[model samples]
Each structure stands twice: as C-alpha cells, then as structure tokens.
Target: MMNSREIIAKRVAKFFKAGDLVNLGIGMPTIVANYLPAEAKVMLHSENGFIGLGPTPAEGEEEKDVVNAGAAPVTIVPGGACFDSAMSFALIRGGHLAATVLGALEVDEKGNLANWMVPGKMVPGMGGAMDLVAGARKVIIAMEHTTKEGNPKILKSCSLPLTAANEVDYIVTELGVMEITPEGIALRELASGVTLEEIQAKTEANLIIPDKIDIME
Candidate 1:
C-alpha cells in the first residue's frame, strides 16, 4: 500500500500535461515537483520570482536569496529565469499560470480554502494564495486525509479563515481524490485500497459519490 506522501505524489502526477505552467505551494504541495513526468515539459513558477524551477537544493549548498515562495531553499534548472516578486505575481494574476497545487488547513463543501492563519495559533500569512486561487485556471489542493489527531480536513464548512471562495477544483488525500463542484465534493476517485463507504465514513462532511468510481492505482 502507498503511504500518504506517495499517495499525494501519485495524485499530483496524474494532473501533469505537456507545456503546462504550474505553481506548487509549501510543504506537501512542493513535493509535486519531484513527481512531474520527465518526458512532459512542465514549467514551474515560483512566487518568489523564478520560473522553470527544479528541485530542492542539496544540504549545505543552500542559497539565501534563491528560495521558493515559502522561503525554503531551492535549486533551479539550467534554463531557469529569475524576476522580481511583483513581476512574478503579474504572471500569476495575469492568468499565465495553468494550474496550482496548494496545501490547505480546511476545504469546505463549497470549495472554499482556508490555509493561511489558524487564528490564535499565528500561522503563516495568506501570501500569494489569494492570487493563485483567483487567477490560476485550476487550483488543486494536496493534503492529508485528516489532521494529526485523525480529524478530517474535508468539512461541510471551514473553521479557519478562508483564503478564497469556490476556488478549489480538485483535492487529493491519502484516502481518495475528490472533485469539488459548485454543490459539494463529488467523489470522482478513490485510492486503490480504499472504498467509497470507507472514505465517507472517515470524512466529516457530506460526500457525493458518483456512480462511476475511478480507482487510482
């Protein structure tokens, strides 16, 4: 059976296409870069001002200025280009990005995202998520099925602060892949070892399981 990280990687890989421009958010979202198809050329856009990005830099070889939007150090591809942060947002806000993979705290039935601050806990600022959700052609969220204590992240309504409304199109969890529609999360696919009833039982929100189940093997 695939672990949580591997499951996220597999789900991300399925979304790849040739000549697509994509942005990967912090943490699990950043892992998508390592799984992208080698044969298919996908241009990676970093909100910190680099396009055509590569993987994370080696240990002890970190560059202070060369980092991702999350401030984590990164390595660039041979043909990579760097620009100002303002100019980078221009590309994202101008709708040049085809898709974005973001990590979220909570995703409601209406496809709203809440990833920024956790209120009293003082989490990371909203950052570029606002623009990414509103501008990207498609926004996919890559996260675990539940919280550290096993509470579901997919909910009927988000408890944390929202980043955007009705923005998320797809969501990948260890349990399954849920396609967010105007009404709610449509159960389009499930992991190879998981079942629709199992996922629904684990999830805290109402799930719309489609008649046809696309099992991701």
Candidate 2:
C-alpha cells in the first residue's frame, strides 16, 4: 500500500495530459511530478522563473543553481528554459497554463481556498498563489484530507483568509478525489480501503456522492 502523500500524488497526476503546461505548487503538489506518466509530455512551470522543470534530482547529482520555486534543487529537462520573474508572471497572468496544482490549508464547499498564512504565524507573503489560482485555466488542489490534529480541511465555509474565491476546480487528497461543481463538492472517487463513512467523518463539507463511485488507481 502506498503512503498518504504518494496516494494523493499518484491520483492527482492522472488529471494532466500530453502537452499540458502545469505548475506544481510547493509541498504536496510537487510530488505529482514524480508520478506523472513519462509519455504525458507535460511542461512544468515554476513561479520563481523557469519551465520544463523535472522531478527531484538524486542527492549526489544536485545542480548548484537549478531549483524549483520552493528553492529545492531540481533537474531541468532538455529544452527547458530559465527567465526572469517578469516573464514568469506574464506567462501565469496571461492564462497560458493548462492547470496549476496547489496545496491548501482550507478549501470550502464553494471552492474558496485559504492556504497562504495562518494568522499569528509570520509568512513571507502570499507569494504567487493568488495569481496562480486566479490565472491558471484550471486550479487543482493537492493536499491531505485532514489537518494534523484530525480536523477537516474541507469545510462548508473557510475560516482562514481566502487565496481565491470559487476558483478551485478539483481537490485531491489521500482519502478521495473531489470536484467543485455548480451544485457542490462531488465525491468522484475513493482511495482503496477507505469508506464513504470514513471520508464524511473527515470532511466538514457535504459531499455529493454518486451511486457509482470509482476507486482511485
């Protein structure tokens, strides 16, 4: 059985297709790159200023300068390019990306996201999350099902400051995959060995579970 993080990453990776320009946000979202199918031919964008980002480099093979937006050493695929922040924001704000996978602290039934800062904790700033969620053609959230204290991160309404209003399209977690729709949050698939009752207990939002829910691959 795969661990929780790997389960989420593997499930989230299925959303991308060939030729898609995707931005994998820091944290859990970055793991999606490792699970992407080799033939997908997806191009990764880093907000700090690079594209064609590859998976994490082996420990001994780390490049001194090549890194993702998270400042973690990474590999650049062949034909990848590096540029200034101006160009990076231009590409993002221009809505050229097919999708952007991000991690979130809270996601409400209305698809509102709040992930940047937790009130008392000092943070550098909101970073590119604001632009990424609003600018990306599709915003996919990759995060755990619950907080460390066993609190539901998916709620009927977000308590934290929102990163974007009604912008999230999909939410992928260790327990299941959910899609925000006009009606509400739809439970599309459940991870193997997890039950509907288990998911509902961990989710504060009312899930629209279909009769024929599929198991996550």
Candidate 3:
C-alpha cells in the first residue's frame, strides 16, 4: 500500500496534463514524478537551471553533476539541457512555466501560502519560490493534511511568515483536494477512507464542501 505522502503525490499528478512545463518543489511534490503517466509527455523544469528533466535516477546510476534545485540527483530527458541560474530565473520570472507543484507549511482560506520559514528555525532562505508562485501559470500544492504534531496545515489564516499572498490555486493533501476560490477554500475531493467530518475537524479553516465531491480512487 502506498504511504500518505505517496498517495498525496499520486492524486496531485492527475492535475498535470501533457505539454505542461512543470517545476516540482523539493519535498512531497517531488514524488509526483514517480506517479506521472509513462506515456504522458511533460517537460520538467528545475529552477537551478535545467529543463526537460526525466526523473530521479536509480541508485548507483546517479550523475554527481545532475541535480534539481533541491539538490536531489535526477536524470535528464532527451531534450533536456542545463543553463545558468540567471536564465533559469528568467524563465520563471517571465512566467514561462505552465504549472508548478509546491509543498506548503501552511495555506490559509484566502489562499495565502506560508512555507519558507518557521519562527526561530534555521533555513538557508527562501530561494526561487517567490518568483515561481508569481510566475507559474497555475500553482498546485501537495502536502500532508496536518503537521506531525497533529496541527492543521490548512487554516483560516497562517500563523507563520508567509511566502506569498493570495496565490495558491489548488491544494492536495493525504486526506483531500481543495481549491482556493474567491469565495473561500472549497473542498473538491476526499481520499478513500477520509470523511468530510474528519477533514473539518482537523482543519482550522472553513471548508466549503460542494454538493458533489469527487471521491478519490
């Protein structure tokens, strides 16, 4: 059986159609590659300066120089090539990316996203995320339904520092799929064995459940 992380990524992949130029965030979002259709033709872009990346290389088959922005070893597809970071940011800043899958620390009802820093925690800094969110044609978030401490990540408002304001388009977690709409957060789908009651109980935000919700298979 797939774990919750794998399950979330698998569900999120369905939103990435062929021909999309996608940038995958480092953590849970990275697993989406493993779940994409083998026949689908999608271009993977890395903010660190590569496009047309294939997928994570198998163990022992890694190329030390080939890595994504997250520094994870990856394989390049046939047409993939590396460029400098300036060119990479140029693509992102120019809004050339069709879609971007991201991992979130917290997403508020108003679609505000907070992922870069936690108070008193150490991190290098927020990299290209601000540009990615600003420029990507559409943003898709993949993350857990709740934090390890059982705190809801989908909230009425983020308590942490925000990475961006009012940009999140869609959210996919282990328990459900939600869309950020002008009205509020709309619960679009629920994973198998998850209940609307459970989602509402765990979430700190007001979840709008449509009359018809897609039950994830």
Candidate 4:
C-alpha cells in the first residue's frame, strides 16, 4: 500500500510538463520537487525570493539561508537567484508562475480552496499562500482524503477562510485525483483498494464520476 505522501507525490508529478515555472507550497507539495523526471525542465519558484530551485539536499549539503516555504532546507540549482520576498511576490502576482502546488484544509466542489487559517484554532499566519493561488496559471492542491479523525477534507463548501474562490484546477488526495470544473468535481482517478461508491461515501462534495473510473495507482 502506498502511503499518503507517496500517493500525493505521484499524482502531483503527473501534471508537470517541461519548462514549467512551478511554485511548491509548504508541505506535501514540496515533495514533488524531488520526484520530477531529471530530464524534465521544471523550474521551481520559492515565494521567499528565489528561482531555479532543486530537491532537498543531503544532511551535509544543507544551506541555512536556502529554504522552502515549509522552512525545510533545500538545494539551489545552478543559476538560481535569490531576491527580496516582495519582489518574489511581484513575480507571482505578475503571472510569472506557470503553476503552484498547494496544501489545502478544504476544497469545494466548485474548486474553491481554503487553506489560510482554521477558524478558532491557534495557528501561524496565512503566509504567502494567497498570492500563490491568485497568481499562478494553475493551482493544484495536495492533501489526504480525510482529517486525522477520519472526516473528509474535500467538501461541498469550505469551513475555513478561503484562499481563493473558484480558482483551484486540480486536487490530488490519497484516494484519487479530481478535476475542478464549473459544475463540480470530476472524478479522474481512484486509488487501488478504493471504489467510487466508497469515495462518494467518504466525500462531502458532489462528485461526477465517469462511466469508467481510472485507477490512479
């Protein structure tokens, strides 16, 4: 059985094309940087002001000054440039990013994303998430199927503050891959050991399953 992290990584890697300028958010989204094909020309963008990102480095290779949004030490690729956080945001806001992979708290059927803050829960600031979702050409969310207590994270509507309303394009979970559309979520793939009925039972959002389901595993 594939663990949640591996499942999310595999799904996220499928969306990339060569030469894409991608922004990887704090958590699971950062794993995709390590899994992409070596020959693929995907340039990573760090919201803190760096381009030409690379995978997490070895223990001895860690650079204290180089980090992803998650604050994890990461290796910088050749020709990488670091600048001010403000300028980095300008790049995102200017639509310089091709895509951004973000982690979400909840995702609606209409592709609305809520990842900023959990209402009533003490947490850090929302950070640069708002800019990433708004400026990227495509927004992909990486998360698990349910919360720690076994409740769904994908829902008909979000319970937390929204990062972007109707802006998400794709969602990848341990259970499957869903494409967001104007009508609702389109079921694109189901993981091994998962059935459409089971997925529907576990999900809170309205799902549009195809006549034939694609097994994502």
Candidate 5:
C-alpha cells in the first residue's frame, strides 16, 4: 500500500496535463513533482525565482545554488529559466501560472483556504501563497485528511484566518479527492481501502457524494 503522503501526491499529480506551468508550494505539494506521469510535459515553477523546476535532487547530487522556494535543493529541467524575485512574483501575480498546488491547514466547503499561520504561532510571514492562490488559473490543495491531533482539516467553515477566500479549486487528501462545486464540496473519488462512512465521519464538511464514486488508482 502507498503511504498517506504518496497517495495524496500521486492523485494530485493526475490533475496536471501536458504544457502546464505548475507551482508546488512548500511542503506536501512539492512531492507532486516526483509523481508526475512520465509522458506529462509539465513545467514546474518555484516562487523563489525558477521556472521549469524538476523533481527533488537525488541524494549526493545536490547543488548549493539551485533550490525551490522552500530552500530545499531541486533540479531544473532543460530550458528552465532563473530570474529574480521581482520577475517571479510578476509571473505569479500577472496570472502566468496554469495551476498551483499548495498544502492547507484548513479548507471549507466554500473553497476558503487557511494555510499560512495559526494564532499566536511564530511563522515566517505568508510568502507567495496569497498571490499564488489568487492569481493562478487553478488552485489545488494537497493536504492530509486531518491534523496530527486527528482533527478534521476539511470543515464546514474555517476557524483559522483565511489565506484566500473561495479560491481553492480542488482538494486532495489521503482519503479522496474533493472539488469545490457550486453545490458544495463534492467527493469525487475514494482511495483504496477507504470507505465512505469513514470519510464522512472524519470530515466535518457534509460532502456531496455522487451516485457513482470512482476509486483512486
């Protein structure tokens, strides 16, 4: 069986198509780069000023100067370009990204996202998340189903401060893939070995289950 993070990343990678200029946010979202289908010609973007970002560098092959927005060493594909922060944010805010995958602390049925910081916790100020969510053509959230304390992250409404209001397009968790539809949060697929009742019990949001639910590969 795939691990929780791998399962989430694998499903999230399926969302991208050829020619996509995608951005992977700091944590779990970055893992999606390693899982992209070999045939899918996607260009990964790093907010720290690199486009055509490649998968995580292999052990012992790390380059000191080449890194992702998270400061982790990463590879750059052929034709990748590097520029300064001004140009990077310009691309983000100018709506050049095809999609952005980000990890969220909480997401509501209305597509509200809250990922930057928790109350009173010391955190680096919200980086490009605010701009990426608002500017990307599509915003996909890659997060665990619940917090470490086992509390649901998908809620009826976010209790944490908002990162972006109603900006999330799709949410992929270990349990399944959900889409923020006009009707509500729609449960589009279920992971292997997961049941509908278990998902419902764990999620605070009332998921709109379709008559036919597809199982995630």
Candidate 6:
C-alpha cells in the first residue's frame, strides 16, 4: 500500500492532462510534481515567478534563489521562464492556468476554501491562493483527511478565514478523490481499501457516495 503522502500525490496526479499549465501550492501539494504522469506533459507555474518547473533540488547541492513558491530549491525545465511578481499574477488573474493544485486547511460542502490563516496562528498570509482559486480554470485541493488533532478538514462549512468561495473543482486525500458538487461532497472515487462507512465515520459533512463506486487501485 502506498503511504499517505504518496497516495495523495498519485491521486492528485490523475487530474493532469496534456498541455496543462499547472501551479502546485506549497507543502504537501508540492509532491505532485514528482508524481505527474510522463505521458501527460504539463507546464508548472510557480507564483514566485518561475514557469516550467522541474524536480526539487538534491540535498547539499541546493542552488541559491532557485525555488518554487515555498522558497525551496527546484530545477527548471527547458523553456522555463521567470518574470516579475506582477506579470506572474497577471497570468494567474487572467485565467490562463488550466489547473492549480493547492493545499487547504478546510474545504466545505459549498466548495469554500479556508487555507490562509487560522485566527491566532502565525500563518505567512494568504499568498496567491485567493487569485488562483478565483481565476484558475480548475482548482484542485490536495490535503490530508484530518488535522493532527484528528479534526476533519472536509466539512459542511469552514470555520477559519476563507480564501475563496465555491472554487474547488476536485479534492484528493489519502482516503479518496472527491468532487465538490452543489448537492454536497461527492465521493467520486475511494482508495483501494477505503470504505464508504470508514469515510463517513471520519467526515463531518454529508458525503454523497455515488451508486457506482470507482475504486482506485
């Protein structure tokens, strides 16, 4: 069985298609880079100003100032280009991205995203998520099933500050892949060994399991 991070990354990778201009958010969502299918060619855009991102740099060989939005060193593929933050955001706000993968703290049934801050917590501010969620052609969230304290991240409503409203197109977690629909959170696919009952037990919101199950192997 795949580990949690690997499970989430692999599942998220399934959404990528040919000719996609994608942006991967910081933290766990960044791993999606390593799992993208070889047949599906994608151009990775970093809000920090680089496009056509490659793999993360090896340890002890880190180069200065070559990084993703998280400031971690990353390799640049051929044809990659860098621009000022203004131009980078222009590309984002202009709706040129085919899909953007983000890591969220909470995503409600209404598809609202709350990923920027946690009230008293010292978060680094709401970076470019507000723009990405609102302008990307498709917004996909990659996150863990629950918080460290076991609180479900998927809910009927978000309690924390919101980054965008009704913007999530897909959600990939360790347990499954979900579609945020008007009716509710739809369990479009489940992990090989995960069950609807198990997902229901852990989820706080109403889950819509389709009549047909697409069990991911």
RMSD (Cα, Å) for all candidates, in order, is 1.7, 1.5, 1.5, 1.6, 1.6, 1.6
lDDT of 6 by residue, 16-79 (tens): 7888899988888888888887778889999999788888778987788888777778889887
**lDDT of all predictions, in order shown?**
0.85, 0.91, 0.87, 0.86, 0.90, 0.87
| Tens digits of per-residue lDDT for model 3, 1-217 | 9999999888888887787888989888888998889777878898888998876788999998998787778889997878998999888878888888898889999889988888788565789888898888888888988999998999999988888899899998888899999999999999889888999998999999889999874
**TM, every model:** 0.92, 0.94, 0.94, 0.93, 0.94, 0.94
lDDT by residue (tens digit), candidate 1, 118-154: 8878876788899999889999999988889988899
Worst 10 residues of 5 by lDDT: 117-126
- Better-scoring candidate (lDDT), 3 or 4: 3
lDDT of 3: 0.87
Candidate 4 ranges beyond 4 A from true positions: none
Q: Who wins the lDDT comparison?
A: 2
Q: Judged by lDDT against the true structure, how good is candidate 1?
A: 0.85
| Worst ten in a row by lDDT for model 2 | 117-126
TM-score of candidate 1 relative to the true fold: 0.92
* Winner on lDDT (2 vs 3): 2
lDDT of 5 at 196: 95
Angstrom error at residue 172, model 1: 0.4
Model 6 CA lDDT for position 183: 91
In model 2, how large is the Cα lDDT of residue 73? Answer: 92
Native-to-model Cα distance after best TM-score fit, residue 39 in candidate 4, in Å: 0.7
Per-residue alpha-carbon lDDT of model 4 for 1-217, expressed as tens digits? Answer: 6679988888798798998888988778877776788788888998877998777788898888888767878878986888998889988988888899998889999788988787678567778888888889999999988889989888998878888888899989988999998889999999988888888888999799779878896
